[model samples]
Target: MFIQKKYIINPHFMYMAGQFDRNAKLCTIVTELNRTFIVDKSPLEILNDSIRCIGFDLRGAMETAKFLLGNKYMCPIMVNPIHKICVFPDKSSIHNDVKWFNPVHIARTFSSNQQAMIEFTNGLIITVPMKLYSFNHKLQTADQFRKMMLSIEQDPFSFEKDPRKGA
Candidate 1:
């Protein structure tokens, strides 16, 4: 366990959960490579800082997600598209309690007691207080967003042509 005044997200980052400490003070739990970082900032702030630290803006990422997927809310963001670093939130970032999870770091997810249980690649499991269906939907949405971004990056100008047409 360690305390960090500011955090820059990296490939090893697993998730960022906004939570209240023992004193009921707002803080964020950042998990990276099985290391815990108790950040004195909200999840949104941490995300924005990380993005900006890498020369990207939070709004640009959100807008891109929305434009690509037509998502109105809770859209996943690709913090660094070149590195394929994408993450999605279970709820609105402004919400007092929200968790931003990187899909790449997640090993699996299961439903139990109507809630969603996340299993990290490191074998850590934690239950989230949200409907399993909703959680799964969010995860799928994030996956979709990531795929779209990757496809675009791989061939932004390439287009599919029918062989029968003989282009």
Candidate 2:
């Protein structure tokens, strides 16, 4: 119902896709915990801005994820590790039809005809144009990525160097 000029991807943001309608071309469809709105920017634009807001750019986020997930395609991006807002794209990021989803808020995904259906924790259901098996694989990867990040951060031995940087 509401059209926003810009948006940041946060914990409340469930998923965002580039939707084409009469009023807008490839506008971002942002679904949050409390509501869904339309953003004038494209999905990638929103993602880039969101990551930059937290002191990094989209390429940096993707490259870090790719490095950690070597040989794994469709890597899940950890936008804000402290906030636990990680997301994975359905298609390649260069594709205009890509849809980014945060698996944390996803209740479940099931097959519907030749596509997949995602049920959000907030009871929002949307069909994705992807095979059930493929969708599930991506979801599992995102889960794994999130777990790995949390484990590394929460490790008991994690500590900064005691001595001064120059010393």
Candidate 3:
């Protein structure tokens, strides 16, 4: 007889809380494991600060996400050539009439990750597993993944931020 252990991890309420907070003014990305980066912020400062703090270029991430999402908008990812960073308002907070892109593509891409979770600009949570690239089954009860994400989000220096200033 084979015993399959059930993995149960609680979702991080802080992420959900931050998503609903309209006055949040900062965002940060912390790497918990080898290739995972957890995005957390007040939804106001996430776009800009994540680029500054995380080594991965925001332009690349945005372009990747945009391309993956199949956004019809031709707007370049970076408005400022020098800064190479885009600071647009969180799309999730906008009214339905203002939304121009489909998040299904983005969500699908996230669902393809080997082990990943993406908190969209609109507060949607997407969780992906390593073996999911071939099998696209959506795992709704991912407690360990949520716990790992929350752990990284709460720790500022998990990704190597300055310990003195406190990220």
Please list the Cα RMSD from the true structure of every candidate, rounded to 1 decimal place. Answer: 5.0, 5.8, 17.4
Q: Against the true structure, whose lDDT is highest?
A: 2
Candidate 2 local lDDT, residue 128: 92
How far out, in Å, is residue 35 in model 1? Answer: 1.0
Report residue 57 deviation for candidate 3 (angstroms).
Answer: 4.9
Cα lDDT for residue 2, model 1? 84
Alpha carbon deviation, residue 79, candidate 1 (Å): 1.0
lDDT ranking from best candidate downward: 2, 1, 3
The CA lDDT at 37 in model 2 is 93
Candidate achieving higher lDDT, 2 or 3: 2
Q: Under the 3 Å rule for N, CA and C atoms, how many clashes does model 3 have?
A: 5
Kindly list the per-residue Cα lDDT of model 2 for residues 1-167, writing each as its tens digit. 89999998888999988887696487888889889899989988998898898899988988877766665777998888889889999998877768899999999999879899999999999999989999999999999988877876798367333354321
Judged by whole-model lDDT over C-alpha atoms, candidate 2 comes out at 0.86
Give per-model TM-scores: 0.87, 0.87, 0.23
Better of 1 and 3 by TM-score: 1
Q: lDDT scores for all predictions? A: 0.85, 0.86, 0.31
Please report how far candidate 1 places residue 75 from its true position, in Å.
Answer: 0.6
